[model samples]
Target: MPVIVAASALLFSSASLAHQLKSSVTTVLFNKRTHNIELMHRFYLHDTEHAIEHIVGKQADMLNSKSDQLQFADYVAQHVAIKTPESESIKLKNVGFEVDGKFFWVYQEAPMPAEPLSGLQMSHGALQELWPTQVNMVNIEGQGKVRTVYFDQQNQWHTVTF
Candidate 1:
């Protein structure tokens, strides 16, 4: 009876703690120079979107200004820590513009080839989709010029630039 209750309590506590340890936000940093996107998961144990929304909403209300939209951008950089896809630690030096309402991030280091000769590639077209706004040009470091195709909200692909 007592032992059973104690065991249940312990299990519940551990489960709660484990949930708290996992990251809530998956941050993808784009390096135009290296032509690689570094995906990171922030392990602050809370949902990143919720936090941003809450902070930004509060700030907007307080300021009563439309310009407060940029507050969320500032909050992310101040509170969020960069983590790798595997939940490893990473250091982000700068986080730049928020394109199409999503923040664009930059890292201190250029990406190195994980495998010896295999070329770097992204599994998905995340780079293009990361920023919802139209991109005019994409210049990758070391890799020279890269091509990009832009589509509108209607999914119509019209523009292509190198």
Candidate 2:
């Protein structure tokens, strides 16, 4: 009877390790100014919806099952709009996901639209979107200086200046 109990303990331990090996990490970023919520789904090659379900509960299966061709960017944009925020416009900048050190969706926020034509004509000739097309050009809160290394399309990890 003791032998049988020991074997069961071993089996359970191995199963727990196996479960841990198949899980992934997801990072979500929410910007209050732009009212944007970005999600990054990171998974290993052998990992599946079942594994994701085990890690993040039952709701994981529904999200992990989404096809690669699905428009995640548009979906995120729409999802942000539906959730709504106190701010008028919040930009989703630098949405990225990493799987085994591989990065995906290195998107940067687009420039803000110009003011009305009448306003533009009255003021100094300055384009509303004059700042850089990249993310976090201004160093506010000191977080912008600490650059995050992300893998480019060429599979090379580059330190991008924000």
Candidate 3:
């Protein structure tokens, strides 16, 4: 009876929820004063650690290791991209990264549009290779409006107009 109970406990353990969902959320803000678009991406720390280990072959305890945090920032910068309304690519400058308990945050910035503020295209390609079910949600906040967009393997890019 004890053995049966132990087996059941192991089968339905909390460890099973390690990779239950692969998702991240990002918020983009247009800084009119700085003429830059600031980005903040929030992710589950556990999932991000696993992903870093898979990609870089090192478990990055983001809170403890500066190099690991930099690596994560680089990884995020590579996977995500921005484009102007005219289809020209915009360079995203990675500001930094931080660990807040169970969540990890990455900071980024890009040059604001030189012309009128019509629309912008953003592509979020993080974790798609490692996790097939990965979905990234991005929120754009500017001009007294907010919009949400989802990014998956199939739908990676979204053009948001304000």
Candidate 4:
């Protein structure tokens, strides 16, 4: 009985260690003054490190290596998109990326459309391929209110209105 109990405890402990929270949050702000849509994505530092290593097929030093961070940022940029209701792409330019404490952030921005927009479609799949349980949430702030959209392994595109 003791042996069985010990084995069960070990199993549970191993499972707990293997499970990590796979999630990311992005804030999209429409700066009317600048006429730009700014995006800031926040992710777990540990997860980003592992993902960078897996994506580059080598050990990635995300904390100390700027190249690794840039590579990961590029990967993130390729997996994210913001489009208009008419399917016109909103060209998002990579602003930069940085690590702050236990989190890593990727920044992007695009010029706002000259015409008024009713809604925007967004897609985020940065780490979903590697970890199917990964969930990405985007909060868009504009016009004195905030709209939210979520993405996961199953659902890719979500539309939000300003």
The RMSD (Cα, Å) of candidate 4 is 3.9
**Each prediction's whole-model lDDT (CA):** 0.36, 0.32, 0.87, 0.91
Off by over 4 Å in 1: 19-37, 42-46, 58-162
Models, CA RMSD each: 16.5, 16.3, 4.1, 3.9
lDDT of 1 by residue, 15-120 (tens): 8876544222333435555655444422221232334445555423212323342453444344333333344444444434323223323223335335322122
Candidate number of the best lDDT:
4
In terms of lDDT, the poorest run of 10 residues in model 3 is 10-19
lDDT by residue (1-162, candidate 4, tens digit) is 999999999999987765577999999998888899999999988999999989989998889999999998999999999999889999999999999998899999999998988889989999999999999989989756788778998899987765
What is the descending lDDT order?
A: 4, 3, 1, 2
In angstroms, how far off is 151's CA in candidate 2? 29
Clashes of each: 1, 5, 0, 0
Candidates in order, TM-scores: namely 0.28, 0.24, 0.85, 0.87
lDDT for model 3, please.
0.87
lDDT of 2 by residue, 37-75 (tens): 343444343333333344345544323444431333333
Off by over 4 Å in 3: 1-19
